[model samples]
Every structure is written in structure tokens, then in C-alpha cells.
Target: MKIKFFRTIWWKLLVSYLCLILITTVISYILTTATFRTIRIKERQMEIEIRVERIARIIGELCKEDEKIENIKGNFNEIARISGIPLQMLNPEGKVVAFSRSSHPKFRQIKNINLQPFEMRKLREGKKFSYTQYYGENRKKLYYYICPIYREGNFKGSLVTAVPLGLSRGFAIMLLNSVLIATIIAFILAVFLSRSFTRPIRRMGEAAQSMAHGDFTKKMKLSRKDELGFLADAFDEMSSQLKRNIESRMKLMGDISHDLSTPLTTIQAIAEAICDGVIDTEEGRKKYLESILNQTRRLSFLINDITELSKFEAGEVKINKTLFDVVEPIQRAVESAGFLAGKKEIQIEISIEDEKLQALGDMEKILKAIQNLINNAVQHNPPGTKIRISATKEKEKVLFSVEDNGQGIPEEEIENIFNRFHKVDKARTSGASRSGLGLAIVEEILKAHGEEISVTSSQQGSRFFFYLPYLDPASADVFLDK
Candidate 1:
């Protein structure tokens, strides 16, 4: 999708970077210019003071002989020419005595230089002073430095020097130009840097769009170790999970439809045949009715299994855990499956490490799980095969195992045996009445109890086992209320 320039991350980042650079540039320029001006002014003041002191000394020497002020006009003019600054000699009364010649028109117009009251006071005290004043219509600044002249322990007149206030205009222009160049360079870099930073995000956005369209194959190939890379990895994982779930859901729907439709079609056909009087004999009619009844029962069982599995998957099934004798459930499950085992001519053997061993879990669910495992062994094995059911205490847990000496499950199918509607090869076993949901129910029940079931199979037989925390009866009082 096309995104607006102003709303994009690149735009925001670029604007932020440029704004920072602009603010920094402006602040740096103001500070640097101010500092440069202060240093230049101080240097100029020192230079002017040195030159004014020399002129004061010259005036003092000339005045020892009581020479007139006009006689030293030539000296003042020469000093002004050499220093490129205007000069004025002031009497003790703060009036101009002798002034220098200058090429500048503004300085030539000056008839007299007046000193402030403070300046006069400082000079009267035989101290030097300096200050700044603006002149003319433009208000141009000029720096003034005055040195007191002394002769024979008496205060002579003061020597004054005046120069315009500023640094070199060429250097100032160069400094400003340098700052502008740097700002332009930084702005250019901000564009590239913002683009580099936002490139991965744009790619991820596109990948998300593809996912929205039901395409889960997009991969973000980013290798960075930053947060963005971590997000990309998570996104990739989510996509893979979504793909797997979608595929599994489709397969499950197909399995359910097939399983349900087979019995439904059979029941429908048989009912129609009986209604049409295809079997009018008493024995034939009774036989067809029995078949219909069996199909109906199969349908009911399938529906119930699907509903219960859904409850488990949706986390709607709460495990009501309590301490219960593990042996009681084992015996109950074996007895419940005795009729089915008898029909298959299978023999069940039970082995208990301790009859009093108790496990912590919902007793009803645990018994149901055990019953499913025992029935699965009976239904999947050949006639006359032997099944061993056992509960043994090891460490702090009770291990329940069921092993059947029948044609074992194939190695490749072992991993998927617990999946819903998954069945083994029919030609290798005898029973065909199972709905293939028994192992799946067992797995979900154990999982809800915070336990896992594992199976090991060889040419001899297959053994399914799981562990539950064993509860000591002495400590069972604490959990009795739960």
C-alpha cells in the first residue's frame, strides 16, 4: 500500500534529526559569534591601551619644557597614521587640547571629544579607563581607551585612542558559511540514515499485508540483533504456526466428515431398506435393526468424543486435582475394558508397585484416560495377545504404563498416534470398531494434568507410559479440601 510521506516513520525520523541539527547549529552559532566578538574586543582594548600609554609618555616628556599643545600635533598625527586609529589629547578639565589628523570623514568632523563624569574621575585619580560609545545616525560602535599622563608627581593631561568595534568581516562571513555547509551535510545524511532505519519496517509491513491476504509464505530475511530483528523472527514464527494450524484444521474437518458420513450413510440406507420392505422376514428385519442401532451408537460416540476434545483444546476443562489411590483407577479401568478385551480374546495383567500409592489429579479424568489406553490396546491388537497394565512409584511420582504384545505400531506413525482421527494400518490388527479418538483423548487428559505421555514400540510390542506426582497419605490432609 502507498503510505503518506508525512505519516511515514522515515519522515518522522528525518524531521527529528534535522530539527536537532538546526537547533544545535543555531545555538552553536550564537555562542561562537558572541565569544569571538568578546575576544576581539579585549585584544583591541589591550593594543589601544599600550599605544595610548606610549603617547602619554611622549606628551609628558614634551610638556616638561612647557611646550604648547599644538607643538605636539605632528606627533599625534604620526601616531594615528601608524596605528590606523584616531587619537585625541585632553586637558585636565576634560576638554580637547590637540587632536590627530585622520582620513576618515567621521573622525575629521569631531571638533572636541567629551569625557563622561566617571571617565574624568578615573583619569583624575591617575588611572587608565576604557569604554564603548555609539556615534552618528547608524549608531556605529567605537571603543575608547584613556591613559593618565604623569609628570613630576603631578597629573598631566590624558591620552585617548578610539577604534571601531568589530572583528574582520571576511572571517565572520567564513565562519557563518562553514556552519551552513555543515547543516546541509547533516540534512543529507539524515535522509539516508532515516531510510536505512525504516527500510526493514517497510518490508515487515509488506509481509503483514501478504499475511492478511492469506499468504503465509513471506519471510523477513533480516539478520540484525536489534529489536526489529527480534520482531521479524517472532512474525516469522507466527506465520509458520498459522500455516500449520490451518493445514491441521482442514485435515481434521475432512477426517470428521468422512468418519461421520460413513455411519450416517449406512444408517440412512438401512432405514430406507427396512421402510421399503426390502427385508420382510422377522430375522432379516431384526438383523437390519441391530445394524442401524450400532451405527447410531457409533455416531453418538463420535459426537461426544469431538465435543470433549473441543472442550480440552479450548481450555474449558478444569482439572479438579486431589489425592486419590492410583491403584483403584487402574483396576477400575481394566474392569471397564474387560468385556471388550474378552471379545478380542485378549488377556490383561496388572502389576502394582504399591497398592496404597496415591497420585495428585482429577480421579475421574485419570480413570477415563486409563480406560482409553486399555481399550486402545484391546481394540488394536490381535486375538490372544497379552496386555500388561502397571502403576509403579519412582521418586516423587507414579508411572502408569500399558504394554501390549501385538503387531507393534510402525516407527514412522508413533509420533502422530496421539493425533485426532489418526489410525494405524487395519491389516495389521483385528478390531475395526474404534473411532481413532481414543489415544487423542488420553493425550489431552494427561496434558491437562500437566503431564505428558510417551510411547516406545519395537518388533515385540508397544508400551505407552506417563508419570503423575505421587501424594503421600501422611501429607494428603493439606490437599483434602482442594
Candidate 2:
């Protein structure tokens, strides 16, 4: 059940934070307890040393065998009371001679828990100046300390002090109450912190979901200058761009429909006029009918291009890969543009040196892309200008390009000309080009075949370029078998 955490970043962040806090708390607890115990032991032992030293000084001048030892024994209890600890004194023979406590709690069994007699005898032979131990005879918890006493350069007795291992009742209650208060305060702060961190994330997530559902109207909210804020701003920019594209496509579709309808209406009206004898002469009627027919053909061509573009963009178009000669197809495309070239008095030329230059790709789409580029060059060229188409085998790829010595594209619209239904200006297009789907259709088809296409235009002229996979002699023959 614990193995499924790789699904997202937030879960990992929460787990990482939990682990880091727990590890830090454990280390802090260990270090704090060690320091506190060392401090407590040192404080208790310092007071014991002072008491033993004073007693040694008082009894140091006493001559032979005085019974003041009883008075001195009572002083041990006074030291324990003043220092907030219990005292157990052992003779040099290691017997438990005395013990003192004001009151014992009900949970304690005082009499059954005592120090071992033999353990004290080894300590009193002028052995340890001071030491400490925990636990008692009945296995109850205690902290026992031993200190040897001296008088006139002879061993008098030993002091065994035992402090309860548990905290005092009042202190224990106070610490527990403090912990409860701290926990409540920390939990409230934690809630506020969690909200501060997750609120921006939630807002970003909702905006993303709306974009996924094709509603690009909403923008992400951002409040900070961190990575999240940068991400939010980027997302907002993406949404604005997407909204503009969607609106443009809708407007273009309406324009395309109107263009096609107007052409068809002209053709229909011309046919009706000819049938009704509205034109008195046959020659006049024939010319009007031919003009209407030309517009009808243009509408048909535009519809076919739009359909191909949709298939390509939707990834529904299939590529039939085969080895084919690149030079002949390019020549054919230029020849097809001869009429437009003649009308503008522009010369169309094709240059190729590699007769065996072969490319593996869909020949039909390649032909269409070249045709569109040539048509663009022809339509946009001034009189007496020249356009050229060329192909060459470069390493593993076949490169094709169409170049025109024309007024070239404007600096601003060169990159955007391939976008769906985008045009630089209304005055610069053919009569039917308010739809503006030419370059977009060309780009989509080439892209579907895993090919690259681009255009560059400057004062030197404009070049439209693309590439296809080059196949050698043996590989080209192998393709012919399939």
C-alpha cells in the first residue's frame, strides 16, 4: 500500500516534509536529553562536595574517638533536604546505617527498594570521591550517587545520595500542560501555512483544466515572484494566444464559406442568363460564362485544399512512402505555373545537376507543396521578374527550394504567413484570398509527413525551403519492390 507515491509532485513534497521534520525532532530530543541529564548530575554533585568538605573541616580538629559522629550523621539529612534530594549513608563496613525522606508517594513501595550492602563497602575504603547510579533493590527507578568523606587523614565514612529518576510531581504536571498548549498553537499555524502554499496551486490547476476543455478565456492568477508565479504568467500568455487563434479560425471559416458561395452564385447567375437569352449575342455570353466558370473552378480548388489541410492537422492523413526522382517533379511544378508567369512576364527556371537524386516520401504532397510555392512566387512577382526552383542531394537528405526575385514579404509577416488563414494585408492577395488558407494548408500537409518547411524573405528576394529523406541506389531499388 505504500509504494504508489510517484504519481505527482505535491504528494512527494508532503512526504519529504514529513520525513525531514520527524528526523530533526528525533535528533533534537536525543541531544537535549543528554545535555539535561549531564547538567542535573553536575549540579547535584557540586552541592554534595560542598557539604562533605564542610563536615570534614568541622571534624578535622577533634582529638580521639568523639561521639559527635551521631551529630555528623544528622547533618547528612540536612544536606539532602537543602539540596532537594534523599540521603543514604554507608559505614566503612558497607551497612546501610541511615536513610531520610519527608514523605513517600502512594505509588512507591519505599521499604522494599534499598541499595545492596556489599556495593557500599567497596566504595568506603577511600575509593571514589564521587559517583552516580540509577535503579534500586526492587528494580524501582532511582539515581544513586556516592561520595567518600575524610577527617584528619583517615577514612571516616561514605555518603550515598539517591534522587528519584522521575520528575517531581509539580514539575511533571507543568511540563505536560505546556506541551498541550504548544501543540494547539502549532496546529493553528500549520493550517494557515498550508493554505498559503496550496491556494495558488489550486488556482493554477483549475485554469489548466479549463484550457484542456477548450475554454481559453480564463487567465491564471499570480501573486509572487517565484517559479510558481512565472509558471502562472506563462500559462496566462498561452491562454491568450490560444483564444486569439480560435477566434481567427472561426472568422476565417465564415470568410471561406462566403468566398465559395459568391463564386458559385456568379456561375449560377451566368448560366441562368445564358439560358434565358439575357445576352443578345453568343460571343458576349460565352465570355461571361467563361469568367464565371473560372471563379467556380477556383472555389473547387480552395475547398479541396482546405479538406486536405484538415486531414493533415487531425493526423488522419496517410503517407505512402516510396523512392522517387526529385528533379522531374520540380520541373513539372514550374511548367504548370507558366501561364501565371507569362501574364506577369516573369521567367520560371529549374536547376538540377544530380540526375540520380532520389528521395523517400509522398510524391503527391511534395508536388502540391511545390505548386503552392510556385503559385505564390508567380502571383506576387512584378512584371519582367524571374523565379527559380531547385533540388539537390545534401548528405542524407534531399533539399528543395523555390526562390523568387520579387518585392519579398514584409519583415513582420514572414513568420506568421504559415498560420491558418493569416494574411499580411487585404490588398496584397488574390481576389479569392480573403480566406488566406494557402500557406497553412501547405505547412500542415508537409508536417504530417514528418517533414520541415520554412520561408525567408528579404531585399535579396524570398526562398521557400523543405527537405525529404535521401535514398541511395540499393535502398531506392529495395523500395521499388514494395
Candidate 3:
């Protein structure tokens, strides 16, 4: 399926960062531009007021020297040329006395300008007034400053100065260009940072998709020392486990078919021979039927073992708990298997550190597990071999082991002995217990009790051992009746 640009993590991250940068740039531009304009306006206003006030004081001093019109015009023209401010002198009655030719044409065209009532009052009170206006075709800004000239507390005339806005349009243009450049830089950096953060997420999504399609061999190879790295490691572990499970399942099916077919094939042939009267004697027919019965029993045993192992693996078996002396079940299993051992003249013995060593677990399952181990030992051993069953206390638990003086398992097969349907080919043909689920079931029972079983073997013998938790002494009172 095609993914939309907006839905992908990389695209989303890039867009989000771009939006944030654009917003910040806009806000920064607005604030900075406003502040700069404000400062420029304030500076222009102050310069106009100071220059006009100084001219007013100079005009007052000149009025004291000579009241000649020609003299005042000359002085005003000189001051305008030097200060770069357009100047005009006005009589107290609001008539223009002198005007600088340096002033804008619009200003020279005005013969007289009456001040507002409030403005005139301010001038009469020996104060100055300032205002701004736009003039000319280009609508350039202009600042007007007016102050009353005084000679020894006597008002002589008003001094007026006009100053054009000092700041040029070029400065604003430069500031705008600067903001644009900053925005571009910020956007580039945003893309880089966003990509760095979202790259891992993109890889994870791809890996997940691959896994969904039953591809367990793919692995995520992130090297970051963060949560993402940990997630990658966990994903690899899960993939490996899944692969093992699939392989084991396939192998189990094949083993089941091969093992089950052997007995059925034998039974079919033997029964067909008897039915066809191929055995000429009645005794031969009876022996053939007995052989068929043995095969039938073997098939039943195999099926039962498979079913029970499945229950144990699925956690469906409920253990009935009780407190019992550990020796009792071990002794019981030995007694049950003694008849078979006697046929081979093998002597089975039992040893205990304490006969009364008690454990908490399912009694029936424990007895069955012990019997399977003893039967295995008897089947594998030569005639006159000695089998020993021992139980001893080990701190808070009891250790039980079955040891046999028989040809030991090879090192390579030891690890797989407890795997379901795992059979030693040599041991099977040597007339050892052929059903391969015995040790597997025993391991499952131990696992259900939260214990583990181990084996140690050499050419001389093999020993299988496991630990069972001892019944707590303080809780023994509760089970005194049993």
C-alpha cells in the first residue's frame, strides 16, 4: 500500500518543525521591526525639539541686538544652511517675518499658519510644541517643532523648524532581508534535527512490517543507547524465539509420523499373516497375536505419553499438592519396577539421608516420574547391573537421584535427552524403553513444581537428579492428618 506524505513520520516531523520555525521567525520579525521603528521615531522627535529650542533662544538674543527684517532673514538662512533644519521666524500675531528658502516648496507657499488654541497657549506660556505630518508627492514624513522667542520675559516672535524623517527606507529593507536569511537558516536546522530524531522510528516501522509477513530473519540494528536500542534488542530476541518454535514444531510432526508408523506397520503385517493362516501351527498363531498385542500396547503408551506431555507444555495439568515423606514415592516406584529388573538379574537398592524428609508436591505425579526413571535404568543396564535410588536433604530442599551402572549417554545427546520424542537410536535398538517421552514428561513435572532436573554421565554410568522443596516446618501442623 502507498503511504501518504502527511502520514509518514519523516514528512510529519519535517512539516511540524518548519511550521514552528516559521512561526518563531514571524514573531521575531514583528517584534524587532516594531522596536526599531519606535526607537527611530523617538530619536527624531528629540533631535527636532532640541534644535528648534536652541534656534528660538538664538533668535531671542538677536532680537535684543537688532529688529531689522534683512538681518533676521540673513541669520535664519545661515542657521538653516548650517543645522540642515528648515527654519522660519514668525511675529507674535502669526505673520511670517522670514522663511528659509531651504524649506520644502510647500512650506514656502504658506504665507501664514495660525497655531491651534492649545498650541498658541503653550507658546504664550514660554513652552515648545512638536507634531508630525506627511508632505509632498512621495508622502515623506516631516516633524514640526515650534517655540516662542523671549527677550527679558517679553515675547518677541515664534521660532519654527521642520525636520524630515531621518531614517531612510533602505534600513527597513535591510532589516527585512536579514529576517528572511535567518528564517532560511532556521528551517534548514529544523529539517536536520527532525530527521535525526525520526530516522529510528522509520526503521522500526519497516522492520515491523517485515515481521508481520512471516519473515523472522530480519533484525533491527540500531546502536543508540536509549529506549529505541532496547526495543531493537527485544525485537531480535522475539524473532529468534519465534524461529526456534517454528523449526521445533516442524521437526516434532515429522518425528511423530515416523515413530507412530513403525508400530502400526508391524501390527498390520503380523495380524495379516495370522489371518492368512501363514503360521501353520496353532502355537505360532498365538505367538503372532501376542506380538500384535505388544505392538498395540506400545502404540497406546506412545499416544498417552504424547497427550500427557502436551498437557504439561500447555500448563493444563493441575498438581494436587500434599506433604509426604520423599522416600515413600521413591520406594514405591522401585518396588513396581523390581519385577522387570529381576528378569535381568539387576539388583536395585535405595539409600536415604533421612527417610522422613518431607516435600510438598503432587504425590501421584512424583511417583510416576520416579517410576519412569527406574524403568529407564533397568531397560538400559546389562544383567547383574546395580541401580541405586537415593534421597538426601540439601538445606531447604531434598535431592533425589537415580543412578545406574550402564553404558552412559554420549556427551552430544545429553542436552537433548529431555526434549519431547528424542530417542537415542542405539539405545532404542538395544531394547531400552523405546517410548521417548518418558524423560520429557519427567522434566515437565519438575518444571511445574518450579524445579529443574540435570544429568551427569560417563562411560561407566549415568545419574539423573532433581531437587524438591522441603515442606516448611511451621506449616507442617496444617497437614498432620495426611
- The positional error of residue 440 in candidate 2, measured at the CA in angstroms, is 3.6
- Candidate 1 residue-pair clash tally: 0
Give per-residue CA lDDT, model 2, range 1-482, as digits (tens).
12354654445555565565556655765565557656765675566566655543453333234433444556655654664545555555555555557423411234333445665555545555443333546554444456655565555655555455533457546655655565556555555665567667777778888888998867776877999899889889888988888888888788777767877888888889888888989799779977886776678777887887778767888888878889767877888888778988899888876877888888887888898888888776678778888898888988899998888899998888887666677665344423477788778767877887888899768999988888787767776686
lDDT of 1: 0.84
lDDT of 3 at 318: 95
- The residue-by-residue lDDT of candidate 3 on 92-149, one tens digit each, is 7656788777886656656376677787778888988777888888887777778898
Off by over 4 Å in 2: 1-46, 49-166, 169-185, 209-218, 221-227, 268-292, 319-321, 334-351, 354-360, 377-436, 444-482
TM-score per prediction, in order, is: 0.86, 0.66, 0.81
Q: Write the per-residue lDDT of candidate 1 for residues 383-443, one digit (tens) a residue.
A: 9999999989989999999999988889999988988888876443223346778889989
Question: Which candidate should be chosen as best, given TM-score against the real structure?
Answer: 1
User: How are the candidates ranked when ordered by lDDT, highest leading?
Assistant: 1, 3, 2
What ranges in model 1 sit over 4 Å off?
1-11, 54-69, 90-110, 115-127, 135-141, 148-158, 167-171, 272-282, 426-433
As for lDDT, the candidate ahead, 2 or 3, is 3
Backbone clashes in model 1, listed as residue pairs:
none
- Highest lDDT against the true fold, candidate: 1
Query: Residue 230: error of model 1 in Å?
Result: 1.3
The backbone clash count of each candidate, in order, is 0, 0, 0
